[model samples]
Target: MRRLAASLATAVLAAVGAVAVVGQPAAAHGAEVFPGSRQYLCWEDAQTATGQLDPANPACADALAESGPNAYYNWFGNLDSNGAGRTEGYIPDGTICSGGDRGPYDFSAFNAPRTDWPTTHLTAGATYEFQHNNWAEHPGRFDVYVTKEGFDPTEPLGWADLELVGSVTDPPDTGGPGGDNYYYWDVTLPADRTGRHVVFTHWVRSDSTENFYSCSDVVFDGGDGEVTGIGDDAGTAEPPAACPDEAPGAPGDVTAHDVRATQAHVMWGVSQSGCVTGYDVLDAATGDVLAATDGSPMVDLTGLDPGSTYEVTVRSRNDHTGAVSDPTAPASFTTTTTTTTADNAAAAGACTATRTGASACS
Candidate 1:
């Protein structure tokens, strides 16, 4: 999920050659709690390790110790498949982060009542962009709640401890290939609340009984999205050394394929070390990252302006170590106007089928 920062110049759209643009047919997966979520913050900590699931933050390390690595691996999936709006008695206290025992994967350790967990800072009464990972995107409403004033993090969290603050249905998507994949919307925090609190999110899917949940730690300490407790030495005993980027070896045989008006294909040989976890394609003209891929040697570059000359380069990536290779020498390609025949237009307008045997579009 972690990659080098890219510019927001490309238009957002669904995956190419994949059916169902929204509400993906796959199982209802998890989301990111904008600012920060337990899983997300923990996932960020784990990426510092060169190999294995080594969390740089102490609390994150404790989470990994308590729950297995799968907690971070499946960070986007803290879901209960049949909650059906029964939250109070249905989900038990102290198990909010893991959604009780519903998971075939155990995330019970994430519910450990601790004040030292990673926290995102926010300004009260401020309208902020809230985002959630859209892994296998689903159509749903998000029920967001925050703990009451004077809520203690050391104590167990119960429904009584929270008050509903925000509710959004089918929020818009800030399309990108960042933070795994996510849904985005804006929400204003309560003006009267202050101090450390737990921001709970419940995603109710319209397609099925499957729902997702999260417990994001936050503080109203006048911070402008500056995170504490993980990277900084705020809670940990020993100050950890900054993680070094171990860039992968430069790729070979880089060539342009499938050049089109709005899209182009680029492929290259794998890194010699075979340690390359992914690839990032960057615009040579603008220096913005165009697209990224995990294992495929080829990537389809979209959102390009037609009749334009594009010089792009590819760089290998290692997600675990936060490392990226030097950009390959630029490969130039010119795109021509794409002609959309009646068949292509009709295909584009047709409702895409989903795994649940339903259409995602009207």
Candidate 2:
């Protein structure tokens, strides 16, 4: 989970008092992770040791043949730029899984209804932490729906067959944008749901008209998020557990700067409560503490390897209540490397200083 930190800056532009002046066409990426979305898991399955896309699942093969690898490469792009949260009346029934094929890529082939396409297993009425990848984070509301009982999986999905299972607005992300990071929330599955059912999620971005859609094939048959139908991992892949959503987790907007070969500085906003005794800097990937600060907003990280990337999240510790707040959306930094030769250093400095005025650094 190396950091590809494109801050969810647009998501919090209002708070920062900034206006977006984007010139290039903006595209976002993400999809449901748990109860693995069709596109998400297929993308995972297509990955091969030879760096080639070879899908093993029959339905995945059919989808690959129809849409090509482009759709699978951009599995998170099942979105509609002009959707603006309009559903039922706007997106047609058969093509709902593809966001009506209005996305930047052609994902129409994924809309085909199939009983096999890598599915997640769950027990009826069980509470589980649902996850949606935040590959490119955005401010949004999520509407999670599951198919009604007696819903036929062999036929294309329709709006009338779905029932609202849960809804959450702007949930907390496990880390910053990219690399297995996701927006997390607890969802209680309907008890009556059995057999083959599709868990559909509609993401309505509040900042823009862009909306994403995900279709997750699942069966409620007394299992624990174990997935089936994808090579040897058919029933071995277990869904990840959700991060705790505790309050007063040090106000967000955690940032890093002054990165160096072995040192860097990270800072964030203050906590809301007086019970916060200190702060802990945690590795965003494993949620392990790397450093601690004595109630300081900023923490200096040292002993980092040169030219290596690290992602870290911050948390507030309340000694009085014996409570620890949730980690901040991760801040990623890569340490810089230095050369021994004086000539190399001077060349590097000159290349960096006025290189901004020139097109090439060399």
**Which of the numbered candidates is closest to the native, going by highest lDDT?**
2
Model 1 scores a C-alpha lDDT of 0.63
lDDT of 2 by residue, 86-200 (tens): 9899999999899898875679988888888899888899888888887566788999999999999889899999999899999998875544668888888898888989999
Query: Which pairs clash in model 1?
Result: 30-76, 32-133, 133-182, 134-182
Structural similarity to truth (TM-score) of each candidate: 0.60, 0.60
Q: Among all windows of ten consecutive residues in candidate 2, which has the lowest summed lDDT? A: 16-25
The runs of at least 3 residues in candidate 2 whose Cα sits more than 4 Å from the true structure, single-residue gaps closed, are 1-25, 233-362
Residue 130, candidate 1: how far off, in angstroms?
A: 0.8
